[model samples]
Target: MDNNKLIEYLETFGALTSKDKLCLIDNVEFKAYKAGDVFLHTGKIANQVGFIIEGVFRYFFYDGQGNEITSYFMSENQFVTNITSFNEYTFSSGTIAAETDCLVLIIDRKGWELFAEQIENWNSIISKITSKTLLEKTNFQRRLINQDAKASYLSLLEQNPSIINRVPQTHIASFLGITKFSLSRIRNQIANK
Candidate 1:
């Protein structure tokens, strides 16, 4: 992972000195995963936060019927974590699985705290990330509640076109809170129109 890119991303939220960037990079560990690998399993306590360097991953939950419901997708340059588990040191309700071969930069909770202490500007960056993530999740849930399957799928496509091509159709259906058949029908209808 290029530490410069990561630092540049952070710079979008606030200015970070080269020394601060180096300090943050020192704590990050690079990891790779196969397409089917599970990065975070449900009910497991996750101590690390991952920054995707390449490929995609899905954060999901299993329903009572043993069906997977994808809550979100993280692509390259994005971050992934079972936030509640990481924050509270409790079991996570969701799992994060690789959708493709992935490379990530991971930092454990301790590393995060150490960096936070060293970088004064990082507090603002962290707050922005937290608020943005919360808003995105809230808006997604609201859309799911108010929109039909087709509308939800269209909205998702409009928002994340790369996901439509990169993620599996079945997973996309789950993410949109629809059955595969429903998704197929929606796709067909969109194609016909």
Candidate 2:
């Protein structure tokens, strides 16, 4: 909800001083969104990144038939951005929307550039961020390639049990590459065990 939280997240990579926190306060602003609000829409360019202070967001894309296919969900304390659009300055291919009423710390491209220039060990922090993001992506890819739907769902349950409580079944199904009906079946099976 504040720079303190952002600074705390930043500290996970390394030590940061009070000065770093203050700099973040100067560079980032807080924004609030109501449930179902569009944070970033497909075809729009995303110039800012957000740190989720509270609530959930889903990354999704519409199919040719206009059905939404959710790619992932991001929860509290995580960063959300269109990586490709931000890096290449292209239109975003996916949409990010608020799954619940939310509060986020936002930093625009210019702010991030300035913050990186001013913050100590900023490159190291960027390296650390890149590593963490890649690890998450790799794990997601691994699950898609190597795990069955039931196994994937179980792994998610093990790592983030609260996800079932936080996001809708359809979104969870999409993330696990299953249908809502299949998710219900999986939950029933797990419950019976």
Compare the candidates by lDDT and give the number of the best one. 1
Let me know the TM-score candidate 2 reaches against the reference structure: 0.92
Expressed as tens digits, the lDDT of each residue in 47-129 for candidate 1 is 89988888899999988999888889988777888888988999999899999999999988899889889998988997888
Per-residue lDDT of candidate 2, residues 24-84 (tens digit):
8988999999989998999999999999898889899988999789887787778888877
User: lDDT of each model, Cα atoms only?
Assistant: 0.87, 0.85
- The best candidate in terms of TM-score: 1
Model 2 accuracy (lDDT, Cα) = 0.85
> Clashes in model 2: which pairs?
none
Give the lDDT of residue 45 in candidate 1: 99
Per-model RMSD to reference: 1.4, 1.6
List candidate 2 stretches off by more than 4 Å. none
